[model samples]
Target: MSTIRWTEDHSRRSARWHSENHSPLPRRVVVADDRMRADHACRHAADGTALLWRGDFHNARQLLQAMGRRLDRRPPRPGSTPSESFDLHRRSRAHRAGILGKVLVLLEDDYTIALRRAPDVRLACQEAYGPPQGPVIVSLRELLGVIGARQWRVKGVDVPALDARIHPHYGVFSPVRGEYVDLVAHTPLPSTIEHRSVTTTAFDLGTGTGVLAAVLARRGVERVVATDISPRALACAKENIHRLALSGRIDVKGPCLFPEGRADLIVCNPPWLPARPTGPVEQGVYDPDSTMLNGFLTQLTAHLRPGGEGWLVLSDLAEHLGLRTRRQLLAAIHEAGLRVTDRVDTKPGHPRAQNTTDPLHAARSAEITSLWRLTSATWPPRASRHDPCAGAVRSALRRGPGSC
Candidate 1:
């Protein structure tokens, strides 16, 4: 086994040290030379080390992504059938995470935008990655995303409320899921102290970029505490809040679900789809169905004030994939000691929903995003119900668990 070492050299024009080949070390690093190799750069296991690349600035980035793909295609162990869904899912996720961690290498001072026929990504790079203090390098994959998102950010999805400007961070899921936000905005705040006195506090769980929190504040909620588990998301939310000048009304928190007190109204647009995301953006779009959603459901009762309802924003696309049945969801809610008081539904009007050429046409075409109003109730855990994947919705519904 070759020993790896980390050293800080002022001579290097890039930032961060990486190891390309430790059994436990990060598997790949982007050097000034642009070769994807297993090299160690950190001092004291990432204390001080730098990698330099030597390929076309654009291609260098593609290589990093290629390395990510390479890392993803690891062969399954012999005689180990990854068949049980939960177990397979766990293994796949662990493998993907390990590869993702390895793909992110260090950056240098003079950052080059890597891609085929790449353009000037300097501005975008500076915007997301920040200006390099000296000669340094960063994960080319991250840099490429910055450029792509920079372009996407420039051509932002118009937010009518905020003058139609939404600048998403480097790898955040863009604000394409506007339908749900619109639903929450339109849903009347159930008669609460916040509505009567205009001083009710609300919690926006998993507030990505504070979009929902900002919306809640705009909708007249006096105080909105936004909680997210991602530090980058927290920073992004803070920046957006400041940009919207709603800083006083919105407070951003990291990790914790509820802080100290219950809210008159708690709104959460947890991951709507039930699947693991392949990358960062997928995190916003997919949530392994019941993983995060289940957590939010079980804990919601403890955080909701008397007569205050928890607004759960969910999508029915999972039903299209035959992945989950409505009963499964309803049962979770009921089991959480919560009852659905009412529901407001919206049809997805995106292009893909009607695009005949899309792969997820079945789900997208018939997709519905709903805000289920949950109040206190007595729910019990029944035996698992028959799943909808067996082809008939009626049979599934008949045998399904009571979700409401």
Candidate 2:
């Protein structure tokens, strides 16, 4: 809990500082209002000074926009390689966010804004921050994001795969990209395994909004267990499962990746990019050092029953950006004692893919999202663990059916 202090009326007043990104508290703060010029505000922000808004709410918003326009006039320097370009773009974004975030606003004890003509944000604040503690100061940009998230929650995102809308929580990732969901929905479910009569059980790992788990259930997987490490994601998934009347067919579990027992099928859609996320919401898009991807592959075999399959829904965008390579991906699967059975690919239909002006547009346009069907290399009764032949058998199986 950090506090921010500013001088007003010849006295110093302080309020609790709230930053979701845990940014350092401003060292210097000054009262700013409608009379403040956007150019001066931009200069102060660049100098690392904070502006505590004491102006009309709408005017403050305009000031923020003005600052953004000024910053955008100067574009980031181009790099020689795709990877370098990506790095530069990320740094440019961070710089812009830092500058725009300098404009701050104060929320009263009960989550009310005292500014003139300010909209009632009590409900939105409560939804994002839980119970109001006391007077708190937050970046105007963050407060606007909170308000937008509330609207999104109220007007749920439509998912054609589920034929229903999924209302995403404040920090939970929304399934706005339907191509990945479609891949899961349309892919043929594995046939009856060795002794089982049908695909009776399934697991959806890191199930953000429970969208994939719900899709599995709707596809007639008798029992589906969804797991996530985020508390907010767990709660969001549970609520969605109940809303869709699939509670009987699905069980929401975990701060862990895998569940207690083996399942006939396991599914994972890890973060696409191998980079550190800037905030909670970005967790769905950026994965530091491909941690989640590697974790899923390494532990996937243990959680899968013999003759069962694991569906890894991933994108080649990282490869396009020069961050990862196809050979490395194949090597990972092989090292995990797993073999690729089949792969289904789809082009991204998101707007960014078509935006020619975006810095990473070339990579986005060339990206291919695939659902890789994998199975344990040593399945259906192989040599004993003590037998040296067992190692050879597993190695041979890795190159057997789907050698990439």
Candidate 3:
């Protein structure tokens, strides 16, 4: 019953087009060009062809449903994981490539909202896709996401920050991870505001929901600068900050990485696991061999004001999962010319931690979230950043996985 479909208004509707920006597609496809007779079109598509119906909008949707059900009825491969993820990922990808291989949409050169009752999605689409170049004929998924975001904006996330609501997008990483927030809010400080001159400046790196920055402000930090690279995340952060009435106090920017200037304190809640993300959403969960973590540590010394703390909220799940070691983690901190002054740990109470069905149930069950107080230091400085036996982090990209 869900209106879930991929759209590509600007993309070539033909499946044969193998373009770079576009995901890899099939070699050729057949467009139906007319109202489809279910059996006839199904048979033709079965022969490695597509049924691109130029008929009623609702009918096209109905036909897609039929095709999906038909596909679902087929038996799965032997030894398949039944959502086992590891192997299912491989099969799901292959299935996607094949089915999408046959899809072809019939559209005019300039894409337009021409359906009998298509919603007024012009503004939302423009925001996500930019001004349409000669009209963008896109996939159904993109269109739906745009319209969905519009609804979210009309409504909101009910933010206690602005005490209003911070609207979020469909795919944006929502502020569901609240454990870290509690850690930041409750953690003891290593040093009081010893500022000969109290600076209102603070920087929050990878401000996912701007929740931490909001927390910092709520804790009495004056001005906070938040930075993130993802547009969706940036939007969510801005919305949250503005809703909290901290727009005047907090500035959010799209920094490729860290922001400039010395901060009273810089905070980052990096991805906990040391693994590659399988999808766009997974980027928030998996750190891809801990690249982002290393980047923050490597750059922490430069951005932090003297005597300021770089608060790193991280989970020990990687260690619990036997993926990384604590010694290596401390070593990385040491190699970055920084030292952990203090750290406060918290246990996760999420249902997932107690769920035995999850593939990583054991690790998740034992996860420990902590806020590490970091200070720039030269103590135990690496003999060389790359010396393998030097006993710490390796090269920036290579420092994840094993040696922490």
For each candidate in the order shown, give its overall lDDT on alpha carbons: 0.63, 0.88, 0.62
Query: Mind giving the per-residue lDDT tens digits that candidate 2 earns over 1-404?
Result: 99899998899999999998777898799999999989999999989999999989999999999999999998888789999999999999999999999999999999999999898999999988989999999999999999998898899999988889999988899999987888888778876433487548999999999999999999988899999999889999999999999999999999998999999999999999999988889999999999999999999999887778999999889999999998899889999998776676666678988899898988988887778878898875332334221222222123322111
Segments of candidate 2 deviating more than 4 angstroms: 193-199, 380-404
Please give the distance, in angstroms, between residue 229's alpha carbon in candidate 3 and its true position after superposition: 2.3
Residue 166 of model 3 has an lDDT of 53
Please give, for residues 1-404, the per-residue lDDT of candidate 3 as tens digits. 11112334545432222211243333234445336665565566556554444455666556655655666665344332222433443465446434533434322333345665545666775555555554333434334445776687667655443344555654455555556666666555435343436756778888877777887787777788888877877887887777778898888988556877777688898888787654445567778779999999999999876677788988888787665788889889899998765555666666788787655566677676767777877534222244322333212114321111
CA RMSD of each candidate after superposition: 8.7, 6.1, 8.8
Please give each candidate's TM-score. Answer: 0.67, 0.92, 0.69
Best by lDDT: 2
Error of 2 at 315 (Å): 0.7
lDDT of 1: 0.63
Candidate 1 accuracy as TM-score: 0.67
Scored against the true structure, residue 177 in model 2 reaches a CA lDDT of: 91
Q: Which of 1 and 2 is ahead in lDDT?
A: 2
- Between candidates 1 and 2, name the one with more favorable TM-score: 2
